[model samples]
Target: GSSGSSGQALASDSEEADEVPEWLREGEFVTVGAHKTGVVRYVGPADFQEGTWVGVELDLPSGKNDGSIGGKQYFRCNPGYGLLVRPSRVRRATSGPSSG
Candidate 1:
Protein backbone atom coordinates (compact mmCIF):
# COMPACT_ATOMS: atom_id res chain seq x y z
CA GLY A 1 0.00 0.00 0.00
CA SER A 2 2.98 2.30 0.59
CA SER A 3 4.00 2.62 -2.99
CA GLY A 4 5.34 5.71 -4.73
CA SER A 5 3.28 5.25 -7.88
CA SER A 6 0.03 5.24 -5.92
CA GLY A 7 0.93 8.59 -4.38
CA GLN A 8 1.56 9.99 -7.82
CA ALA A 9 -1.82 8.70 -8.99
CA LEU A 10 -3.54 10.45 -6.10
CA ALA A 11 -1.85 13.70 -7.07
CA SER A 12 -3.23 13.46 -10.58
CA ASP A 13 -6.72 12.79 -9.27
CA SER A 14 -6.68 16.08 -7.38
CA GLU A 15 -5.51 18.00 -10.42
CA GLU A 16 -8.95 17.42 -11.92
CA ALA A 17 -10.54 19.79 -9.43
CA ASP A 18 -13.73 21.18 -10.93
CA GLU A 19 -13.85 24.79 -11.99
CA VAL A 20 -16.19 27.26 -10.28
CA PRO A 21 -19.40 27.61 -12.23
CA GLU A 22 -20.64 31.05 -13.26
CA TRP A 23 -23.62 30.79 -10.92
CA LEU A 24 -21.46 30.53 -7.79
CA ARG A 25 -21.61 33.73 -5.78
CA GLU A 26 -20.31 35.30 -2.60
CA GLY A 27 -21.76 34.14 0.77
CA GLU A 28 -21.91 30.58 -0.55
CA PHE A 29 -19.91 27.83 1.15
CA VAL A 30 -17.12 26.23 -0.83
CA THR A 31 -13.96 24.23 -0.64
CA VAL A 32 -10.76 25.74 -1.95
CA GLY A 33 -7.96 23.82 -3.61
CA ALA A 34 -7.92 20.32 -2.17
CA HIS A 35 -9.54 20.54 1.25
CA LYS A 36 -9.91 24.06 2.62
CA THR A 37 -13.56 24.89 3.28
CA GLY A 38 -14.94 28.38 3.81
CA VAL A 39 -17.72 30.84 3.15
CA VAL A 40 -17.21 33.32 0.34
CA ARG A 41 -17.31 36.81 1.81
CA TYR A 42 -16.29 38.91 -1.14
CA VAL A 43 -16.09 38.26 -4.86
CA GLY A 44 -14.76 41.10 -6.97
CA PRO A 45 -11.68 42.98 -8.08
CA ALA A 46 -9.45 43.99 -5.19
CA ASP A 47 -8.72 47.64 -4.51
CA PHE A 48 -4.94 47.33 -4.90
CA GLN A 49 -5.02 44.95 -7.83
CA GLU A 50 -6.76 43.91 -11.00
CA GLY A 51 -8.47 40.59 -11.77
CA THR A 52 -11.12 39.04 -9.54
CA TRP A 53 -10.41 37.50 -6.13
CA VAL A 54 -12.64 35.57 -3.78
CA GLY A 55 -12.24 36.42 -0.12
CA VAL A 56 -13.10 33.40 2.02
CA GLU A 57 -13.71 33.17 5.74
CA LEU A 58 -12.14 29.78 6.22
CA ASP A 59 -13.63 27.16 8.47
CA LEU A 60 -10.31 25.78 9.61
CA PRO A 61 -8.57 27.64 12.40
CA SER A 62 -5.28 27.97 10.51
CA GLY A 63 -6.78 27.82 7.04
CA LYS A 64 -5.36 31.11 5.72
CA ASN A 65 -3.71 34.46 6.33
CA ASP A 66 -5.42 37.53 7.76
CA GLY A 67 -8.07 39.15 5.56
CA SER A 68 -5.68 41.90 4.52
CA ILE A 69 -3.60 41.85 1.40
CA GLY A 70 -0.75 44.40 1.32
CA GLY A 71 -2.16 45.74 4.62
CA LYS A 72 -5.59 46.60 3.24
CA GLN A 73 -8.90 44.99 4.09
CA TYR A 74 -10.39 43.14 1.19
CA PHE A 75 -12.64 41.28 3.58
CA ARG A 76 -12.63 40.73 7.34
CA CYS A 77 -12.11 37.57 9.39
CA ASN A 78 -10.03 36.25 12.29
CA PRO A 79 -6.31 36.06 11.75
CA GLY A 80 -5.19 32.82 10.08
CA TYR A 81 -8.73 32.21 8.84
CA GLY A 82 -9.08 34.33 5.75
CA LEU A 83 -7.92 33.65 2.22
CA LEU A 84 -8.11 35.25 -1.19
CA VAL A 85 -8.09 32.78 -4.06
CA ARG A 86 -9.27 32.78 -7.62
CA PRO A 87 -12.78 31.45 -8.06
CA SER A 88 -11.25 28.73 -10.17
CA ARG A 89 -9.73 27.29 -7.02
CA VAL A 90 -13.10 26.92 -5.34
CA ARG A 91 -15.69 24.14 -5.61
CA ARG A 92 -19.23 24.01 -4.34
CA ALA A 93 -19.55 22.52 -0.87
CA THR A 94 -22.54 20.67 0.50
CA SER A 95 -25.46 23.04 0.88
CA GLY A 96 -26.46 21.73 4.31
CA PRO A 97 -24.75 20.36 7.41
CA SER A 98 -23.70 16.75 7.40
CA SER A 99 -25.83 14.33 9.39
CA GLY A 100 -22.99 12.32 10.79
Candidate 2:
Protein backbone atom coordinates (compact mmCIF):
# COMPACT_ATOMS: atom_id res chain seq x y z
CA GLY A 1 0.00 0.00 0.00
CA SER A 2 1.14 3.52 -0.83
CA SER A 3 1.06 5.88 2.14
CA GLY A 4 1.01 9.27 0.50
CA SER A 5 1.03 12.46 2.54
CA SER A 6 -2.18 13.41 4.28
CA GLY A 7 -4.18 16.65 3.65
CA GLN A 8 -4.34 15.86 -0.03
CA ALA A 9 -7.39 17.83 -1.25
CA LEU A 10 -10.00 16.79 1.28
CA ALA A 11 -12.26 19.70 0.47
CA SER A 12 -12.16 19.06 -3.26
CA ASP A 13 -12.86 15.40 -2.75
CA SER A 14 -15.57 16.16 -0.21
CA GLU A 15 -17.46 18.05 -2.87
CA GLU A 16 -17.75 14.87 -4.85
CA ALA A 17 -18.36 12.90 -1.69
CA ASP A 18 -21.51 14.97 -1.28
CA GLU A 19 -23.10 12.43 -3.57
CA VAL A 20 -24.38 10.76 -0.40
CA PRO A 21 -28.17 10.60 -0.85
CA GLU A 22 -29.81 13.74 0.46
CA TRP A 23 -32.39 11.65 2.31
CA LEU A 24 -29.71 9.41 3.78
CA ARG A 25 -28.67 10.64 7.21
CA GLU A 26 -27.43 9.20 10.45
CA GLY A 27 -30.18 7.54 12.53
CA GLU A 28 -32.31 6.89 9.49
CA PHE A 29 -33.76 3.40 9.12
CA VAL A 30 -32.52 1.69 6.02
CA THR A 31 -32.27 -1.72 4.43
CA VAL A 32 -29.41 -3.28 2.54
CA GLY A 33 -29.86 -6.24 0.25
CA ALA A 34 -32.91 -8.39 1.00
CA HIS A 35 -34.08 -9.03 4.55
CA LYS A 36 -31.34 -6.96 6.13
CA THR A 37 -32.49 -4.03 8.25
CA GLY A 38 -30.30 -1.56 10.08
CA VAL A 39 -29.92 2.02 11.23
CA VAL A 40 -27.66 4.51 9.61
CA ARG A 41 -24.75 5.33 11.85
CA TYR A 42 -22.24 7.04 9.59
CA VAL A 43 -22.60 8.71 6.23
CA GLY A 44 -19.49 9.94 4.53
CA PRO A 45 -16.22 9.01 2.91
CA ALA A 46 -14.20 6.28 4.57
CA ASP A 47 -10.46 6.26 4.98
CA PHE A 48 -10.27 2.69 3.72
CA GLN A 49 -12.48 3.06 0.68
CA GLU A 50 -13.41 5.60 -1.95
CA GLY A 51 -16.65 7.48 -2.43
CA THR A 52 -19.47 7.92 0.10
CA TRP A 53 -20.21 4.94 2.37
CA VAL A 54 -23.06 4.21 4.74
CA GLY A 55 -22.31 2.69 8.12
CA VAL A 56 -25.18 0.59 9.39
CA GLU A 57 -25.80 -1.26 12.63
CA LEU A 58 -27.72 -4.30 11.52
CA ASP A 59 -30.56 -5.66 13.58
CA LEU A 60 -29.12 -9.14 13.08
CA PRO A 61 -25.70 -10.69 13.18
CA SER A 62 -25.37 -10.70 9.42
CA GLY A 63 -22.84 -8.10 8.34
CA LYS A 64 -19.29 -7.71 7.13
CA ASN A 65 -17.49 -5.53 9.70
CA ASP A 66 -17.90 -3.70 12.92
CA GLY A 67 -18.04 -0.32 11.24
CA SER A 68 -14.32 -0.36 10.62
CA ILE A 69 -12.00 -1.06 7.74
CA GLY A 70 -8.27 -1.68 7.64
CA GLY A 71 -8.20 -1.29 11.45
CA LYS A 72 -9.87 2.14 11.22
CA GLN A 73 -13.08 2.51 13.18
CA TYR A 74 -15.90 4.46 11.55
CA PHE A 75 -18.68 3.49 13.93
CA ARG A 76 -19.19 0.98 16.75
CA CYS A 77 -21.47 -2.09 16.75
CA ASN A 78 -21.46 -5.69 17.82
CA PRO A 79 -19.28 -8.07 15.88
CA GLY A 80 -20.89 -9.15 12.57
CA TYR A 81 -23.59 -6.58 13.03
CA GLY A 82 -21.93 -3.60 11.42
CA LEU A 83 -21.49 -3.02 7.72
CA LEU A 84 -20.50 -0.28 5.30
CA VAL A 85 -22.26 -0.26 1.97
CA ARG A 86 -22.67 2.06 -0.95
CA PRO A 87 -25.49 4.54 -0.72
CA SER A 88 -26.92 3.15 -3.92
CA ARG A 89 -27.46 -0.23 -2.25
CA VAL A 90 -29.34 1.24 0.68
CA ARG A 91 -33.06 1.86 0.72
CA ARG A 92 -35.29 3.78 3.08
CA ALA A 93 -37.02 1.09 5.10
CA THR A 94 -40.76 1.13 5.18
CA SER A 95 -42.37 2.48 8.31
CA GLY A 96 -44.36 -0.73 8.90
CA PRO A 97 -43.23 -4.18 9.92
CA SER A 98 -41.54 -6.22 7.28
CA SER A 99 -43.61 -8.87 5.57
CA GLY A 100 -42.52 -12.48 5.92
Candidate 3:
Protein backbone atom coordinates (compact mmCIF):
# COMPACT_ATOMS: atom_id res chain seq x y z
CA GLY A 1 0.00 0.00 0.00
CA SER A 2 1.13 3.56 -0.79
CA SER A 3 -0.11 7.08 -0.16
CA GLY A 4 0.16 9.93 -2.64
CA SER A 5 -0.39 13.71 -2.35
CA SER A 6 -0.05 16.63 -4.68
CA GLY A 7 0.87 20.16 -3.72
CA GLN A 8 0.21 23.26 -5.76
CA ALA A 9 2.35 26.36 -6.00
CA LEU A 10 0.92 29.77 -6.74
CA ALA A 11 3.06 31.67 -9.21
CA SER A 12 3.04 35.46 -9.23
CA ASP A 13 3.35 37.33 -12.51
CA SER A 14 5.72 39.91 -11.10
CA GLU A 15 8.76 38.70 -9.20
CA GLU A 16 9.48 42.26 -8.19
CA ALA A 17 6.46 42.22 -5.92
CA ASP A 18 8.17 39.71 -3.70
CA GLU A 19 11.23 41.89 -3.43
CA VAL A 20 9.22 44.58 -1.67
CA PRO A 21 8.30 44.21 1.97
CA GLU A 22 5.26 42.05 2.68
CA TRP A 23 3.77 44.81 4.85
CA LEU A 24 3.64 47.08 1.85
CA ARG A 25 0.46 46.33 -0.05
CA GLU A 26 -2.36 47.92 -1.93
CA GLY A 27 -4.74 50.07 0.16
CA GLU A 28 -2.19 50.20 2.98
CA PHE A 29 -1.48 53.68 4.26
CA VAL A 30 2.14 54.72 3.68
CA THR A 31 4.38 57.73 3.85
CA VAL A 32 6.21 59.02 0.81
CA GLY A 33 9.44 61.07 0.95
CA ALA A 34 9.45 62.86 4.29
CA HIS A 35 6.20 64.74 4.83
CA LYS A 36 3.54 63.15 2.65
CA THR A 37 1.01 60.39 3.30
CA GLY A 38 -0.89 58.24 0.85
CA VAL A 39 -2.47 54.86 0.20
CA VAL A 40 -0.69 52.13 -1.69
CA ARG A 41 -2.37 51.69 -5.03
CA TYR A 42 0.12 49.51 -6.88
CA VAL A 43 3.24 47.58 -5.89
CA GLY A 44 5.28 46.15 -8.74
CA PRO A 45 7.53 46.95 -11.66
CA ALA A 46 6.85 49.81 -14.04
CA ASP A 47 7.39 49.57 -17.77
CA PHE A 48 8.97 53.00 -17.76
CA GLN A 49 11.44 52.22 -15.02
CA GLU A 50 13.60 49.46 -13.61
CA GLY A 51 13.24 47.69 -10.27
CA THR A 52 10.11 47.79 -8.06
CA TRP A 53 7.93 50.88 -7.94
CA VAL A 54 5.26 51.88 -5.48
CA GLY A 55 2.23 53.70 -6.77
CA VAL A 56 0.56 55.87 -4.17
CA GLU A 57 -2.44 58.16 -4.20
CA LEU A 58 -1.34 61.08 -2.14
CA ASP A 59 -3.79 63.09 -0.03
CA LEU A 60 -2.42 66.25 -1.59
CA PRO A 61 -2.48 67.28 -5.24
CA SER A 62 1.26 67.42 -5.60
CA GLY A 63 1.94 64.14 -7.34
CA LYS A 64 3.18 63.90 -10.92
CA ASN A 65 0.30 61.98 -12.51
CA ASP A 66 -2.96 60.10 -12.00
CA GLY A 67 -1.30 56.69 -11.76
CA SER A 68 -0.34 56.48 -15.40
CA ILE A 69 2.83 57.13 -17.28
CA GLY A 70 3.80 56.94 -20.97
CA GLY A 71 0.28 55.84 -21.94
CA LYS A 72 0.34 53.11 -19.31
CA GLN A 73 -1.90 53.17 -16.26
CA TYR A 74 -0.52 51.40 -13.21
CA PHE A 75 -3.37 52.60 -10.99
CA ARG A 76 -6.21 55.10 -11.04
CA CYS A 77 -6.51 58.23 -8.92
CA ASN A 78 -7.37 61.89 -9.17
CA PRO A 79 -5.22 64.04 -11.41
CA GLY A 80 -1.93 65.04 -9.84
CA TYR A 81 -2.49 62.59 -7.03
CA GLY A 82 -0.61 59.61 -8.40
CA LEU A 83 3.13 59.02 -7.93
CA LEU A 84 5.47 56.12 -8.57
CA VAL A 85 8.54 55.87 -6.40
CA ARG A 86 11.00 53.18 -5.43
CA PRO A 87 9.90 50.88 -2.64
CA SER A 88 12.88 52.08 -0.61
CA ARG A 89 11.31 55.52 -0.40
CA VAL A 90 8.01 54.24 0.95
CA ARG A 91 7.22 52.96 4.41
CA ARG A 92 4.14 52.03 6.41
CA ALA A 93 2.68 55.04 8.14
CA THR A 94 2.73 54.89 11.94
CA SER A 95 -0.47 56.88 12.31
CA GLY A 96 -2.48 53.80 13.17
CA PRO A 97 -3.54 53.06 16.77
CA SER A 98 -0.70 50.55 17.01
CA SER A 99 1.73 53.46 17.11
CA GLY A 100 3.09 54.04 20.60
Candidate 4:
Protein backbone atom coordinates (compact mmCIF):
# COMPACT_ATOMS: atom_id res chain seq x y z
CA GLY A 1 0.00 0.00 0.00
CA SER A 2 2.72 2.46 0.94
CA SER A 3 4.82 1.43 -2.02
CA GLY A 4 1.87 1.76 -4.35
CA SER A 5 1.16 5.23 -3.05
CA SER A 6 4.78 6.27 -3.48
CA GLY A 7 4.85 4.84 -6.96
CA GLN A 8 1.73 6.76 -7.85
CA ALA A 9 3.26 9.95 -6.56
CA LEU A 10 6.40 9.38 -8.60
CA ALA A 11 4.31 8.70 -11.67
CA SER A 12 2.39 11.90 -11.12
CA ASP A 13 5.61 13.84 -10.85
CA SER A 14 6.97 12.27 -13.99
CA GLU A 15 3.79 13.11 -15.86
CA GLU A 16 4.22 16.74 -14.83
CA ALA A 17 7.79 16.79 -16.09
CA ASP A 18 8.67 17.89 -19.60
CA GLU A 19 11.03 14.95 -19.95
CA VAL A 20 11.64 11.80 -17.94
CA PRO A 21 15.24 11.10 -17.08
CA GLU A 22 16.49 7.52 -16.95
CA TRP A 23 18.10 7.76 -13.47
CA LEU A 24 14.81 8.58 -11.73
CA ARG A 25 13.17 5.32 -12.69
CA GLU A 26 12.48 2.64 -10.12
CA GLY A 27 14.62 -0.51 -9.98
CA GLU A 28 17.53 1.71 -10.89
CA PHE A 29 20.44 0.81 -8.67
CA VAL A 30 23.62 2.77 -7.97
CA THR A 31 26.41 1.07 -6.12
CA VAL A 32 27.83 3.81 -3.92
CA GLY A 33 30.66 2.71 -1.68
CA ALA A 34 30.81 3.94 1.87
CA HIS A 35 33.11 6.88 2.36
CA LYS A 36 33.71 5.21 5.67
CA THR A 37 32.33 1.72 6.33
CA GLY A 38 28.69 1.72 7.51
CA VAL A 39 25.18 0.75 6.57
CA VAL A 40 24.09 2.02 3.18
CA ARG A 41 20.67 2.51 1.61
CA TYR A 42 18.83 4.29 -1.16
CA VAL A 43 17.39 7.79 -1.24
CA GLY A 44 14.58 8.97 -3.48
CA PRO A 45 13.71 12.29 -5.08
CA ALA A 46 11.56 13.09 -2.06
CA ASP A 47 14.64 13.00 0.15
CA PHE A 48 16.18 16.02 -1.51
CA GLN A 49 14.99 19.58 -2.08
CA GLU A 50 16.43 19.59 -5.59
CA GLY A 51 18.37 16.89 -7.41
CA THR A 52 17.78 13.80 -9.55
CA TRP A 53 20.63 11.61 -8.27
CA VAL A 54 20.01 9.36 -5.28
CA GLY A 55 22.47 9.19 -2.41
CA VAL A 56 23.50 6.84 0.39
CA GLU A 57 23.16 7.63 4.07
CA LEU A 58 25.53 5.85 6.43
CA ASP A 59 24.83 5.04 10.05
CA LEU A 60 27.51 4.47 12.66
CA PRO A 61 28.30 0.81 13.04
CA SER A 62 26.68 -0.54 16.20
CA GLY A 63 28.77 -2.95 18.22
CA LYS A 64 26.34 -5.83 17.75
CA ASN A 65 28.01 -8.11 15.22
CA ASP A 66 26.05 -6.52 12.39
CA GLY A 67 29.28 -6.45 10.37
CA SER A 68 30.27 -2.92 11.18
CA ILE A 69 32.52 -1.03 13.56
CA GLY A 70 30.76 1.40 15.85
CA GLY A 71 31.63 4.97 14.93
CA LYS A 72 30.47 7.96 12.94
CA GLN A 73 30.34 6.97 9.28
CA TYR A 74 30.17 9.18 6.20
CA PHE A 75 28.83 8.56 2.71
CA ARG A 76 29.61 10.12 -0.66
CA CYS A 77 29.56 9.46 -4.38
CA ASN A 78 32.88 9.41 -6.23
CA PRO A 79 32.71 9.29 -9.97
CA GLY A 80 35.09 7.00 -11.94
CA TYR A 81 35.89 4.78 -8.96
CA GLY A 82 34.29 1.97 -7.00
CA LEU A 83 30.56 2.29 -6.16
CA LEU A 84 30.46 6.06 -6.49
CA VAL A 85 29.84 5.58 -10.17
CA ARG A 86 28.63 7.97 -12.83
CA PRO A 87 25.49 7.51 -14.89
CA SER A 88 27.42 6.11 -17.81
CA ARG A 89 29.11 3.62 -15.49
CA VAL A 90 25.76 2.59 -14.05
CA ARG A 91 24.44 2.04 -17.54
CA ARG A 92 27.42 -0.14 -18.31
CA ALA A 93 26.98 -2.17 -15.13
CA THR A 94 23.26 -2.66 -15.79
CA SER A 95 23.81 -3.72 -19.37
CA GLY A 96 25.16 -7.06 -18.17
CA PRO A 97 24.68 -8.08 -14.57
CA SER A 98 26.38 -11.45 -15.03
CA SER A 99 29.39 -10.24 -16.93
CA GLY A 100 31.66 -9.72 -13.96
Candidate 5:
Protein backbone atom coordinates (compact mmCIF):
# COMPACT_ATOMS: atom_id res chain seq x y z
CA GLY A 1 0.00 0.00 0.00
CA SER A 2 1.24 3.50 -0.82
CA SER A 3 1.66 6.19 1.79
CA GLY A 4 -1.73 7.68 2.71
CA SER A 5 -0.21 11.20 2.64
CA SER A 6 1.14 10.84 -0.89
CA GLY A 7 -2.17 10.96 -2.79
CA GLN A 8 -4.29 12.67 -0.15
CA ALA A 9 -2.32 15.68 0.94
CA LEU A 10 -3.56 18.91 2.41
CA ALA A 11 -2.35 22.43 1.87
CA SER A 12 -1.77 24.78 4.74
CA ASP A 13 -4.30 27.61 5.09
CA SER A 14 -1.59 29.89 6.43
CA GLU A 15 0.16 29.91 3.06
CA GLU A 16 -3.01 31.05 1.34
CA ALA A 17 -3.69 33.71 3.93
CA ASP A 18 -0.19 35.09 3.45
CA GLU A 19 -0.85 35.67 -0.23
CA VAL A 20 -3.90 37.82 0.48
CA PRO A 21 -3.38 41.49 1.29
CA GLU A 22 -4.34 42.37 4.83
CA TRP A 23 -7.42 44.58 5.10
CA LEU A 24 -6.85 48.31 5.57
CA ARG A 25 -6.71 49.52 9.17
CA GLU A 26 -9.07 52.08 10.63
CA GLY A 27 -7.94 55.75 10.81
CA GLU A 28 -5.49 55.11 7.97
CA PHE A 29 -5.86 57.78 5.27
CA VAL A 30 -5.29 57.60 1.53
CA THR A 31 -4.82 60.61 -0.75
CA VAL A 32 -7.14 60.72 -3.76
CA GLY A 33 -5.63 63.41 -5.96
CA ALA A 34 -3.65 64.17 -9.08
CA HIS A 35 -0.41 62.58 -7.90
CA LYS A 36 -0.89 60.47 -4.80
CA THR A 37 -4.52 59.71 -5.47
CA GLY A 38 -6.91 57.40 -3.59
CA VAL A 39 -6.35 56.59 0.04
CA VAL A 40 -7.28 53.43 1.96
CA ARG A 41 -9.55 53.68 4.97
CA TYR A 42 -11.52 51.37 7.27
CA VAL A 43 -9.89 48.04 6.62
CA GLY A 44 -11.85 45.19 8.04
CA PRO A 45 -13.20 41.76 7.26
CA ALA A 46 -15.42 41.52 4.21
CA ASP A 47 -18.95 42.60 4.97
CA PHE A 48 -21.25 39.60 5.37
CA GLN A 49 -24.07 41.42 3.63
CA GLU A 50 -22.32 43.28 0.80
CA GLY A 51 -19.29 40.98 0.61
CA THR A 52 -16.93 43.95 0.20
CA TRP A 53 -13.97 45.53 1.89
CA VAL A 54 -15.10 48.64 3.79
CA GLY A 55 -13.24 51.55 2.20
CA VAL A 56 -13.07 55.32 2.29
CA GLU A 57 -16.09 57.57 1.92
CA LEU A 58 -15.34 60.13 -0.81
CA ASP A 59 -16.43 63.74 -0.85
CA LEU A 60 -16.12 64.85 -4.45
CA PRO A 61 -14.89 68.30 -5.30
CA SER A 62 -16.90 70.80 -7.27
CA GLY A 63 -17.10 70.63 -11.10
CA LYS A 64 -15.83 68.02 -13.50
CA ASN A 65 -12.14 68.72 -13.68
CA ASP A 66 -10.03 65.66 -12.94
CA GLY A 67 -12.39 62.70 -13.05
CA SER A 68 -14.68 63.25 -10.06
CA ILE A 69 -17.93 65.06 -9.40
CA GLY A 70 -18.29 67.99 -7.05
CA GLY A 71 -20.19 66.36 -4.18
CA LYS A 72 -20.03 63.82 -1.44
CA GLN A 73 -20.23 60.12 -2.12
CA TYR A 74 -19.34 56.67 -0.86
CA PHE A 75 -17.35 53.88 -2.47
CA ARG A 76 -16.73 50.19 -1.97
CA CYS A 77 -13.65 48.45 -3.30
CA ASN A 78 -12.70 44.84 -3.78
CA PRO A 79 -9.68 43.05 -5.14
CA GLY A 80 -11.19 42.80 -8.62
CA TYR A 81 -13.16 46.06 -9.04
CA GLY A 82 -10.71 48.31 -7.17
CA LEU A 83 -12.54 51.57 -6.37
CA LEU A 84 -16.14 51.49 -7.50
CA VAL A 85 -17.34 55.06 -7.01
CA ARG A 86 -20.80 55.94 -8.23
CA PRO A 87 -20.79 58.10 -11.36
CA SER A 88 -17.60 56.48 -12.61
CA ARG A 89 -17.47 59.23 -15.27
CA VAL A 90 -16.36 61.77 -12.69
CA ARG A 91 -12.74 62.37 -11.73
CA ARG A 92 -10.98 61.97 -8.41
CA ALA A 93 -10.77 64.77 -5.87
CA THR A 94 -7.90 67.26 -6.06
CA SER A 95 -4.92 66.99 -3.73
CA GLY A 96 -4.90 69.80 -1.18
CA PRO A 97 -5.99 70.84 2.27
CA SER A 98 -9.71 70.19 2.59
CA SER A 99 -11.81 73.31 3.07
CA GLY A 100 -13.77 71.76 5.91
Candidate 6:
Protein backbone atom coordinates (compact mmCIF):
# COMPACT_ATOMS: atom_id res chain seq x y z
CA GLY A 1 0.00 0.00 0.00
CA SER A 2 1.51 3.28 -1.09
CA SER A 3 -0.88 5.31 0.97
CA GLY A 4 0.00 5.74 4.62
CA SER A 5 -2.34 7.20 7.24
CA SER A 6 -5.27 6.93 4.90
CA GLY A 7 -8.38 6.86 7.03
CA GLN A 8 -9.77 9.60 4.83
CA ALA A 9 -10.53 10.06 1.20
CA LEU A 10 -8.92 12.80 -0.79
CA ALA A 11 -11.21 15.75 -1.44
CA SER A 12 -10.35 15.49 -5.08
CA ASP A 13 -11.65 11.95 -5.22
CA SER A 14 -15.10 12.88 -3.99
CA GLU A 15 -15.15 15.66 -6.53
CA GLU A 16 -14.09 13.27 -9.23
CA ALA A 17 -16.68 10.64 -8.28
CA ASP A 18 -19.46 12.95 -9.37
CA GLU A 19 -18.61 12.20 -12.93
CA VAL A 20 -19.83 8.86 -14.38
CA PRO A 21 -19.97 6.99 -11.08
CA GLU A 22 -16.21 6.26 -10.96
CA TRP A 23 -17.04 2.55 -11.23
CA LEU A 24 -14.24 1.39 -8.94
CA ARG A 25 -15.90 -1.67 -7.52
CA GLU A 26 -14.92 -5.30 -7.47
CA GLY A 27 -13.99 -7.06 -10.73
CA GLU A 28 -13.36 -3.85 -12.62
CA PHE A 29 -10.24 -3.34 -14.63
CA VAL A 30 -7.95 -0.52 -13.56
CA THR A 31 -4.48 0.81 -14.05
CA VAL A 32 -2.29 2.94 -11.86
CA GLY A 33 -0.35 3.83 -14.95
CA ALA A 34 -1.27 3.73 -18.62
CA HIS A 35 0.27 0.42 -19.56
CA LYS A 36 -0.27 -1.67 -16.46
CA THR A 37 -3.59 -3.43 -15.91
CA GLY A 38 -5.07 -4.68 -12.68
CA VAL A 39 -8.29 -6.22 -11.44
CA VAL A 40 -10.21 -5.01 -8.45
CA ARG A 41 -10.42 -8.04 -6.23
CA TYR A 42 -11.48 -6.59 -2.92
CA VAL A 43 -12.96 -3.28 -1.84
CA GLY A 44 -13.51 -2.37 1.79
CA PRO A 45 -11.77 -1.81 5.08
CA ALA A 46 -9.21 -4.44 5.92
CA ASP A 47 -8.87 -6.31 9.17
CA PHE A 48 -7.05 -4.54 12.04
CA GLN A 49 -7.04 -1.31 10.07
CA GLU A 50 -9.17 1.62 9.16
CA GLY A 51 -10.04 3.39 5.94
CA THR A 52 -11.27 1.96 2.65
CA TRP A 53 -8.80 0.18 0.37
CA VAL A 54 -8.92 -1.63 -2.92
CA GLY A 55 -7.19 -4.95 -3.42
CA VAL A 56 -6.05 -5.14 -7.00
CA GLU A 57 -4.55 -8.11 -8.75
CA LEU A 58 -1.96 -6.59 -11.00
CA ASP A 59 -0.92 -8.16 -14.25
CA LEU A 60 2.71 -7.36 -13.79
CA PRO A 61 5.00 -7.76 -10.82
CA SER A 62 4.19 -4.31 -9.58
CA GLY A 63 2.75 -5.01 -6.13
CA LYS A 64 3.98 -5.85 -2.68
CA ASN A 65 3.25 -9.00 -0.64
CA ASP A 66 0.18 -10.96 -1.62
CA GLY A 67 -2.84 -9.24 -0.14
CA SER A 68 -1.49 -9.50 3.39
CA ILE A 69 -0.46 -6.41 5.19
CA GLY A 70 0.72 -6.46 8.79
CA GLY A 71 0.27 -10.24 8.76
CA LYS A 72 -3.42 -10.02 7.92
CA GLN A 73 -5.05 -11.36 4.80
CA TYR A 74 -7.52 -9.13 3.08
CA PHE A 75 -7.37 -10.90 -0.23
CA ARG A 76 -5.35 -13.80 -1.61
CA CYS A 77 -3.02 -13.82 -4.61
CA ASN A 78 0.52 -14.42 -5.68
CA PRO A 79 3.41 -12.46 -4.22
CA GLY A 80 4.25 -9.24 -6.04
CA TYR A 81 0.88 -9.53 -7.74
CA GLY A 82 -1.49 -8.10 -5.17
CA LEU A 83 -1.76 -4.39 -4.64
CA LEU A 84 -3.61 -2.82 -1.75
CA VAL A 85 -3.97 0.72 -2.91
CA ARG A 86 -6.21 3.55 -1.98
CA PRO A 87 -9.25 3.75 -4.23
CA SER A 88 -7.82 6.98 -5.55
CA ARG A 89 -4.71 5.28 -6.88
CA VAL A 90 -6.75 3.31 -9.40
CA ARG A 91 -8.70 4.71 -12.31
CA ARG A 92 -11.35 3.00 -14.38
CA ALA A 93 -10.30 2.06 -17.86
CA THR A 94 -11.39 4.20 -20.76
CA SER A 95 -11.90 1.92 -23.74
CA GLY A 96 -11.62 -1.73 -22.99
CA PRO A 97 -13.68 -4.65 -21.70
CA SER A 98 -14.03 -4.19 -17.96
CA SER A 99 -15.35 -6.86 -15.64
CA GLY A 100 -17.50 -5.50 -12.90
Best by lDDT: 3
State how far residue 9 of model 4 sits from its true place (Å): 22
- Clashing residue pair totals per candidate (backbone < 3 A): 0, 0, 0, 0, 11, 0
Instruction: For residue 92, give model 1's deviation from the true position in Å.
Output: 0.8
RMSD list, candidates in order: 12.9, 7.2, 6.9, 11.2, 12.7, 9.4
Per-residue lDDT of 1-100 in model 2, one digit per residue for the tens? 9988777665664434346677899999999988899999998888876778899999999998888889989999998999998887899999887588
* Tens digits of lDDT, candidate 5, 1-100: 7655556443565322312133233333444334333444434333232223434433443212232122322333332323322221223344468788
Q: Ten residues in a row with the worst lDDT in model 5? A: 61-70
TM-score of each: 0.68, 0.75, 0.76, 0.23, 0.25, 0.67
Which digits, one per residue and each the tens of the lDDT, describe model 3 over residues 4-97? 6665564567644436888999999999999889999998888986777999999999899999999999999999999999887898898648
lDDT of each: 0.78, 0.87, 0.89, 0.30, 0.35, 0.76
Best by TM-score: 3
Cα shift from native, residue 41, model 5 (Å): 4.2
With candidate 1 superimposed using the best TM-score fit, by how many Å does residue 84's alpha carbon deviate from the native? 0.4
Q: Which tens-of-lDDT digit does each residue in 5-87 have in candidate 4? A: 44433444543333324553434443334332322232233221333332332233321222111331223323211122222
lDDT of 3 at 67: 97
| Model 4, residue pairs in steric clash | none
Give one digit per residue, the lDDT tens place, for model 6 in 1-100: 5757757654665553322235878889888655667888888887755567888989888888798889888788899999887676778866655477
User: Candidate 1 — number of clashing residue pairs?
Assistant: 0
TM-score of 4: 0.23
The TM-score that candidate 1 achieves is 0.68
Q: Which pairs of residues collide in candidate 1? A: none
